[model samples]
Target: MELAVDAKPTYEVGARKWLITITVITCAIMELIDTSIVNVAIRQISGNLGATVEETAWVITAYAISNIVIIPLTGFLGDVFGRKNYFTASVILFTVASFMCGFSGSIWTLVAWRFVQGIGGGALLATAQTVLVETFPPEELDKANGIFGAGIVMGPTLGPVLGGYLTDNYSWSWIFYVNIPVGIIAAILSWKFIKGGKKKLSGKIDYWGILALIAGVGSLQMVLEEGERKDWFSSNFIIFFFILAITGIILFIVRELTTKNPVIDLRVLRNRNVAVGSALRFAFGIAIYCSVFLYPVFVQSFLGWNATRTGLLILPSAFLTGMLMGVNGALIKKGISPRILLIFGFGMVITFAYILYRLATPAAGEWEFLWPQLVRGLGFGFIFVPAASLTLAGLKGKDIGQASGLSNMLQLLGGSVGIAALNTYITRRIAAHHADLMSNLSLYSQTSNERMQGIMLQLQANGKTGEQARQMAMGIMNGSLSTQSSILAYSEGFMMIGIICAIILPLVFLAKIKKGEIADIGGAH
Candidate 1:
């Protein structure tokens, strides 16, 4: 069955176009916010449900597993059902799941609801992007990208802030409850404004491909999200998932390439721009998500900042990134090479990382981080629009949906890899630094003795006996050493991200993308 490609593609105009843009972008933001919003409430969630922190982490992991599993399938699903119906149904599903999540009495119940929410959330994100691209005419695609990019950058950043505010003032459940109103509005608007195309498939649905996708992507996502927690491959649980991920992914690729009607068209990668763009998007995901993950944890865990303060610290940079997205789009529209913008983006990211690396110390203040974060904002702003434009550039018809899904999948998977790898790296580095520091802490050395004496004297001055003071001095010294080790480990992690960006920087030139090419809506070909 076919939807004839010879027919003219229509785009929304005037207030209708903008309204459609707002509706899709809003849905995308709501999905993204929920991705990270639950993070800040983990402690509260654990306590309220009488679950260990480790058990409650499934609340996050379950959602992530379902999200990645569903993301790449959205394009295929959209084609099977009309895009409008699929998009609106996803919004309703997400809203209902969110409501159920708030009412969950146990950890596993909440996890189940979160998983369902992620299914809808993932569809919302991928379909929303496709909607935005199709809603604008080819010439104004850059502008559509700007609006969509703003939401992309703003969503995860806003999650923690919004979640922190609600959880602190109200309850942990409010984080899920908050999505109800936004999802309702988005669903209504989507149904009212979005157009649906009648699509008829010629063959049976790709049942094997769908199952393989779930096993492959779902298991892989679980590995990334839960690997460090499960102690990597040492844990049999991780090893089992790791095996499943490899086997499932292999079957998935083999089946997709051979199937008459693939769930996701792996053939999209045959296009050079899509291939290269997907790779760069992976790096982009790493840069953005890891920074968001690293900064908040650093401030709140080590710097002793509260949730609100940590979230606020990230606010300015996020806003700056949002503002710059439009400028990047305009520049692209004016015929600036996306490669140039891409390169500039990477350079700024490296600079931001370098600055933060230099400034990572136990005594570093909010002001020091503020400046580098602003530079990061500049990096993200420049990167977001250009990378997206380049990736989907020159694709038309069904390829657009396929490419969008693949690119989004790669980016999300990249974030998972970056976070998991960096978390493991930092943990190992802390132990190494602790050992190195401990080696120099010779009790026989004059410097060590002086330090010990000073600590003991301070303890005594605070009204302690010599024996008690000596033991207290040891504890204080150990704590100080641990803090310094952590600081060093974190500094190196920043550089690791910078090096990743630097490595991916050269791939920008490999793509055969034209200087000013923007994606054509379906039927343009």
Candidate 2:
């Protein structure tokens, strides 16, 4: 197998390019929406399928594992087959699988279909990115990327809200059913508008490398998605996969580095911008996904909001982000440095985290959180556009697809890691907070005595007998304290995220782009 570089294709923008862009973006949004849509429908799925809470979680995990495994391989597949043909086939596969998922009768059946759907859906993401990049000239790439970025940002933010509304108003199956119409439209548009790339034979396909990659990423994703539920490494199943992940990843890297025709071109990472951009992408993934996950859980569990209410609470941040993405896109076109935007984005996100840390309480209201979320949304707008543009700026045309695959893979992997870390951290924090709270609740303390007496009086007034009343009063007191302790734990978790983002801010200075470069790039548009 020998590596070859060939002449790059020229793209002309018109109706064809815009149509193709819309088709690919639609496909991309569908894929991303599926990733988070199930979060809100989990309870309904669990009850309807007669699965336990823990077992039902496999529905999400199975899809995620398959998605991560397939994303990196998308570039290889698109090259092997023609891009348009590959894109069409993926849509068909995803649509068919979604139908099956809706029709599934058992938990295992649904999980199986979700995994199949994920394999198809995963290609939609990186392939869509590559397609959009190549469809536009380098000059107009920022605007193209901006549109794609908006879809990426919007999908996860909208998923929980949409899913919640659908599940409450309709049924859980509607989640999958909703994709059918979107998929059909996208497929039709893709066939009509997408221009296929001329395929160059890059020697023999790296069979060994593909095997190692699947073994590595698939196992690692499974471990991350399920580890918290399985009690981390203590479970034999988790421990076994942990070993599999490490070994497979090591072998995959070695194989990629040594093989002439690697399934994924790990060598592209040698480009400095690509490498640093990938790291930042990873961090961005962590921050975004972890915040989405934690904020809903914190509000619902401690603030006692319903799914609909919690979903609505997040909408303001997302709306603010949408508005800022457009502004940032224009700013890039007007010769602004992305590094400055990146710093501002990071600062706003850290500020939002700090606000959450300080304001979260058992009795905290929606108004308390409104402004913080809006600030966080503004930060996300800053981070997404510039970070995305810079990541691919230095890569040659032939390497775009491979680089997109790798960067997207890191972002997905980072999300899984972030959620697992946040869940585990919150769990540990809850215990620590409870312990500290209990230490100050001795009966000898006047404050403790007064609280106990008040609770006892309330119970007696409710018509309980002496012995039963005292026990009920104690239970109520403990419940109140536990709720307060949980709030404290959540606050600490938010602070930790704030500190992590703050620490990463200095790295923005390391991103090297010449002054006036962005202006030159914009002027080319």
Candidate 3:
């Protein structure tokens, strides 16, 4: 596989480049923030719109689906049109879509606007990374990545917090409205400062490949997102989509491998670094997303904290992650190997998972989670910068864009899978735990009888007749069954995440990077 390096007459790292980088990063962060920000406001939107909780959830799913579908094709689109033109257009589109989303009166209308916003948002993510890399010289790539990584990590972390605050103090529409000004600024800056790359478009676009990719990724994401709610394969919709997803993905792989000019160059995977990096990126996605998804639910449902409180809990950890990103960037600039850092990061995440598994109880407090979450944040920072740096290090000019798109796609898909699988695991475990708890109850057991009697007396005192009290006591026991079941489910969920990290640990050795590979890679940065 011959690597194509499209090196233009290099320009100095002047004010223009920095300005462009900032603009691109800002756009990327805005898009990513919206992805999770709506999560906190789902209840408000549902109540106001008179939609069911399940229907309002489409607001999230629509954006995610459109995002997944468009990300892999960003490189192609950027090449077809000039990068600057494409990027500027995307900003305008995203901004307009945001307005529509905010003004939407019905669930489907909001969903439609979100989907459009996602289409524009997806382009920004990969293009922003490429813009940053090209703006910096090879030597300063680590620092550039550090800056980019900060935005990536901070966006998701801040989303819920910002959304919670906005939803509480102002209206939910403001979440979408907030993007208008940011998008306008980014668009103007990008038009002024970002340079266009020179890539000639072929005669015809790979429409088949685009369709295949959309079908494959879109269907797969839908299955992952809605599988648990719809009972996986049990629902007809899920089953049909599952088959479509599998078929589309298989066809996409075949089509990309065979097409003369592929929509997304799958051939880039021939580069060992890109391949391993993409895989590790998938794992990174799983870890980051699972923690984000589980933490809020754990705090809100089990610990009885409100959304705002849960959002605040993650603030310190986000700061830690931002701090560590800077530190890791400097370390990479020095002669430190990412392999060592990644090992430590993996261990830290496992430790964090174990902490949660052990400390998790029905009554676990916020204080109990503070230190562990901080450790996890540090671990995430350690992995994200190095993993990203190492992944794209060997790729040349056009390959850089392709590799970025692929890695981003895997990360998104991994998150979807992680959330779906964890939800399913929690649901199943809850049932099993409830069964075990119920089986332990017996009339002959003194403690069980005493507990039942206390419940019966309490019901009677609450104005229940003797017969009603007896029935109410049984209902109380059943309710405790659910309470204990939930606790056990959360505990097992944490353990499952730990086991997953452990399973992936050995793959680090398979990365084929030597002790000093960081310097070799860093030199290209």
Which one wins on TM-score? 1
Clashes of each: 1, 0, 2
* Per-residue C-alpha lDDT of model 3 across residues 1-525, encoded as one tens digit per residue: 122334443643678777887898899889889889999899999999999999998899999999999998887787767788899999999999999999999999999999999999999987898777777776777777888887887788888888988998999999999999999899898988877654666556778888999998999999998898788888999999999999999999999898887888899898777887788788877888788888887777767877788889888988888788878888877877777778788788888999998888876777788888898888888887888777876555567778888998898788888889999999999998988888767877888899999999999999999999998899888888898898879877877777777777666676665443322221111
Against the true structure, what is every candidate's RMSD?
Answer: 1.5, 2.6, 2.5
What's the CA error at residue 70 for candidate 1, in Å?
A: 0.5
lDDT tens per residue, model 2, 21-116? 788988998998899989988889999999998878998999999999999998778777878888899998999999999999999999999999
Better of 1 and 3 by lDDT: 1
In lDDT terms, which candidate is top? Answer: 1
Poorest stretch of ten by lDDT in candidate 2: 516-525
The true-versus-predicted C-alpha distance at residue 213 of model 3, in Å, is: 0.4
TM-scores of the models, in the order given = 0.97, 0.95, 0.95
Model 1 misses residue 22 by how many Å? 0.7
